[model samples]
Target: MRGLASASVADQLIDVVSRIAVRDLATLRRYFPALSPDEIADKLVVGTARATEAVGAGVGTAAALPTPPAMPAELAAGVLGAATVECKLIAELHVVYGLRAPGNVRQRAALYLAEWTEGRA
Candidate 1:
């Protein structure tokens, strides 16, 4: 059923966001050393919940149609923006730590996400 399918998608999105947010706290604190642990935790919790809600709303909207539409532009834009921010932060951290990666922003981001998710699994 459409409702079931939508629910499944929402669950997956939430799970991914939750996992990433939990793991990202360390990185967040590392990048923002001035922030207290409580501050980082609060940001992770609120940001992940907000992202999950946005993605869930997008999925619900698509599921209501007689035929599913292409992925919404707003959802796509949000995803891209999030990924870019993550990549930029990571790259900056690498620089701060005197580390190096092999490629451009897109390539490095793709590799980082791949490795990050793989570790989660």
Candidate 2:
């Protein structure tokens, strides 16, 4: 029963991560037409989901994550790198190009992924 409960929780978490990733990628693609859809989805969306999902969400928004517990180091690195890319895209879109919503989503995803990877929950 405990195992099943944990599995269910994990599943729910995955769902949330998926939703955020897909939405964020769609927004990102609008600004950067040069990037392939697959590339945006994999490196940005799924990466955010995996990294954030790993961290759990116990930590508040202001706190920095303390290294993910269950996640492999390589995966964590990939997520952070992706976050950097996302951040750059968002900065260009909002600061220079004046696209706001995408910028917001990307920023939020960055925070969520960092928190998730830190394993606060």
Candidate 3:
């Protein structure tokens, strides 16, 4: 249901992700159990930041940046995982919690994801 039609929310999401990617290993692992501390801490550091910044910069681009070129398989997977979580929770909050509009849903979801990820970090 969610799409990239909303630039503001998408921008917020990028900011959240950038911060999360920089988190300590123990902290990232605690929140994202699917990612090992080493997995997240090692190669993910660069990939995640790049992805985050790409999305952020693309907010004003005519077209969104395609997924980064040749991401480490692991970082690619982590980004997908995080994005899936963001999409699903955002849908739930919109449908169940009565938030309306794709932009609002994304912004709230970004906030929630940031809080959850950062808290553990």
Candidate numbers sorted by lDDT from highest down: 1, 3, 2
The digit string of per-residue lDDT tens for model 1 on 10-111 reads: 444433433332223455667568876556545554664576567667656665666535546445545544543343444444443446457654455555
What local lDDT score does residue 89 receive in model 3, on the 0 to 100 scale? 38
Per-residue CA lDDT of model 2 for 23-100, tens digit only, reads 334466675567764555445545545645554342222134465563454444444444444444333333323333
In order, what lDDT does every prediction score? 0.50, 0.45, 0.46
Encode model 3's per-residue lDDT on 43-93: one tens digit a residue: 444554466566444442422335445344345344445564444333333
The true-versus-predicted C-alpha distance at residue 35 of model 1, in Å, is 3.1
Candidate 2 global TM-score: 0.26
Candidate 3: list runs displaced more than 4 Å. Answer: 1-73, 99-106, 116-121
TM-score of each: 0.39, 0.26, 0.27
Candidate 2 least-lDDT 10 residues: 55-64
Question: Which of candidates 2 and 3 reaches a greater TM-score?
Answer: 3
Name the candidate that leads on TM-score. Answer: 1
Top candidate, metric lDDT:
1
